[model samples]
Target: MNRKTLVLPAVVGLLAPVLAACGGSDDGGDAIVVGTTDQFVASKDAPAPLDPAIGYEAGVWNVLRQTVQTLTHIPRGGGAPAPEAAKSCAFTDTENESYRCTLRDGLTFADGTPVTPEDVKYSIQRVLDIKDESGPIGLLANIDTMETKGDKEIVFHLKTPDATFPYKLATPPAGIVQKDKYPAKSAREGFQVDGSGPYTMKPEVEGDQVTKVVFTRNPKYKGDLKVRNEKVELDLFPDAAAMGKALDDKKIDMMTRTMSPEQAQSMLAKPKDGVKLTEMPSLAISYLAFNTDDPAVKDKAVRQAIAQVIDRGAVAKSVYGSTAEPLYSLIPSGITSHTTSFYDRYGEPSATEAAKILDKAGVSTPVKFTLHYTTDHYGPATKAEFETLAKQLNASGLFQVDVKGTPWAEYRPAQMKGDYAVYGMGWFPDFPDADNYTAPFLDENNFLNSPYRSSVAENTLIPQSRREADRSAASPAFDKLQDIVAEDVPVLPVWQGKQYVASLDGLTGVEWSVNSSADLQLWELGRGRDLPEDGVQGEFEEVVLGLDVPVEGHRG
Candidate 1:
């Protein structure tokens, strides 16, 4: 059977008090199966419309983007190209101002569009034109023009020198879209999906769990994915428990990510036979984003009170289990500019202290605010975690959290403009740099329109660091930024997560990388054994998934 026929059944994965993974066998003898705790956003909906110039989260874009070439890639060490995208990348101009890229010849889009200098030029310019709410528009704002120096050669001339230009390209927002396909202004208007990436997302079953996705050979896919499996398939689950159960039952060939930390720990303790778990340090940071712009949150007392009521440790242990660590900094440890500012200031949840902090601000009857979250963006346990936080804050007496939530679809765009007062957010690094942590959140242009609403110093430092490219010079700027973030308390950092996966034995190339944000590269995986039914099963796996999911959480 073809790749689309390989998704796990809905009954195969389920989440909740009890989780199951690797559901019923494919009935196909040789097919490889995998399980994951996350669900697909489904492609039936219109593309969220990313600005090619400004930055934003790539979301599911990563799964198929492998086929398209970028200026740089996180090559596998002792693995594939340690640097797969660009032949060699660097700041050609000493001022850290000018950036250039040289691509491998013969690289082409999934449709066979040649990866040309103009395509690269258009790709970079597209981001600027869209002016996306995410990504680094402030950084790209400096680029004066881009042109093809020659075949396979592209140059970016910045109004000012920036050493971190390469880091900007590393993000999926900067993904190379086919100029022939994507319009210059995907922001003001919808975009066509003729991307230059490795795989084109399969149309029929885009977002549903067990949806259809196929990664074909990019004859021009000279990027790193070639080193792995050529074809890729992704199966989504409503919750992690179902994903885990599927893995235990051997329903799927490999698993990308699973449910809560405790669940992950249990899987690691007694993994299903032949199933392997790969763990990597994650750049992801979890937070409770406060709308500093909110009149209620604008009061320092209320913000600090909410921050005080949160017990990061409890949230980590209760929902994440041992799979994640309590995080107090926007910048995770091991990354530069990390600090214990939040931890040092709050120490731990203290109702008495929180009350005092509010009283000192002069208005202390009791503060209340709705803690908003979304059902889809993060995962299932998210609602539980938010409720857990609400309980803790209410118990503190100094504050009361009225929990509210939206479906992920509506919630994402609302939070991007920083509209939500206190909403949950997970930050996957744009680039593995401290600057990414500080800059994206503060620059007036960042996703959360919070900009300088809370801290002017932060606004100054982000640009200060970006201009200088020197790590040492950037350090103090980031240092002060972290400290101010903690003091202002616009957003509360909760945990730094560890990337985990449980895959069947037949699967290979289960890599652990700092880049790729530890994303599963489906192309590198396939069935070790042949299907029992062969090509005749046609596409049972996908057919089953495309079926309705009962509200009772059973197969429709």
Candidate 2:
């Protein structure tokens, strides 16, 4: 998505009531308490949801981004990677295979230990060494080796010429950690956070689930971001309804990640007192991924037929309302080389067409299969979205679809194990590039851990695209890659989402707090003057207040 601000439609006569209703709270003395539906569950299979090397979900990264500092980070207004812990960084070789970085003078961890090139090397190395099935090892698969040039410089030798490597380093997965604090070869268990970022975290855990995390400004920090809020508290909720209620009761300064369609619509129609809604365009997408090895959907025709019958528009309208739009390609609309490949191939939802494809492949009628989705991960609408999908497929009379809902804790491991014939997943980009959308799902060592693979995408196209220093010049390769995904139908695109952040009228930097990718930049949030009782004097005008950040960038 382009880094630009968006203005919302003006709501006539609604501003006065909203401004009057906006009130103030002195609950956590100068601390901003933010509410979210994002959950972090620590299970036996995934014991360390907060460990940088193991946790790969958006919620985990949300916490990690606040505490762990990266060598390079996306700047506040969403541009190219800027120096964070490092004083400066660049690729040493013309091949884009050898990258180097020089750390800032006197960078130290939260515990006052000075950061070294060795610690940076160890942090990157451990991610590869641990290689957790559900972790972000795929993001670093291009690295051949790492070397420390001096006390402050670190060099990475890549296996291939990957221009996107620096963007990967900007992600939380590549977050720097103290070599001694984190294990060398295993995921560190528990919810403790130790890094050199802008904040110091203190998490409150119940059993394995993290309920609340309190963040305090790090006095020993050095980075690009300015810490606007001295203290921020993130309180977790089970679903959007609970989160919405918390916002209504003045319990939280803001509610982000998700607000249900009904809640968003109601607020938009009749503005709630003291609350302002900011809607930002998102690169985040929700889709269905097939377990290609499973008997039910192993055949390419079976997958294609189901893809043909899915009504993405209906799913977006009926389930998500204005918060989402139907997505037609593996790459969603705002990205560099987005295409309507699915729409071009399928045209529209057609039962007859789907039946013909199934018959041509000699597939059995009423192709009985189960569709699985996570209950709490995406939003309250996910269950409805899948149920609608099942209804759409079953209505076609070519398939008999049964819907099932599982919590993310169990759903993710099951999906990774290829247990679900067809499962729902969402993507928030690791970075703002078409390569992130393709490589992680189509590569041989895919992040999905499924049997699906395309030699064209993995070998030729992906490598060709990465070779271009100018990302736009690589569109042809990405175009072909997206076309290949449409033909194969291993994954079906559903809807592209718009981020909704509901904050009190007095809150400052709500627009700048979340980036385009939907990751929370808590440092951007702060308290500001309350809205005037007379109301905002303007037409329905929406303005992009700050940088577009991720809402909840994860594989939910």
List model 1 lDDT by residue over 90-148, tens digit each: 55665666666676656566676677777777876877776755444554666898867
TM-score of 2: 0.90
- Give the clash total for candidate 2: 19
lDDT, each prediction: 0.55, 0.75
Task: State the lDDT at 43 in candidate 2.
Answer: 77
Q: Which one wins on lDDT?
A: 2
RMSD values for the candidates in order, in angstroms, are 10.1, 7.6
Per residue, candidate 2 scores C-alpha lDDT tens digits across 200-284 of 9998889888889989888778776777767888888877778767766767776675667777778778876666766665777
Number of backbone-clashing residue pairs for each candidate, in the order shown:
57, 19
Q: TM-score for model 1?
A: 0.80
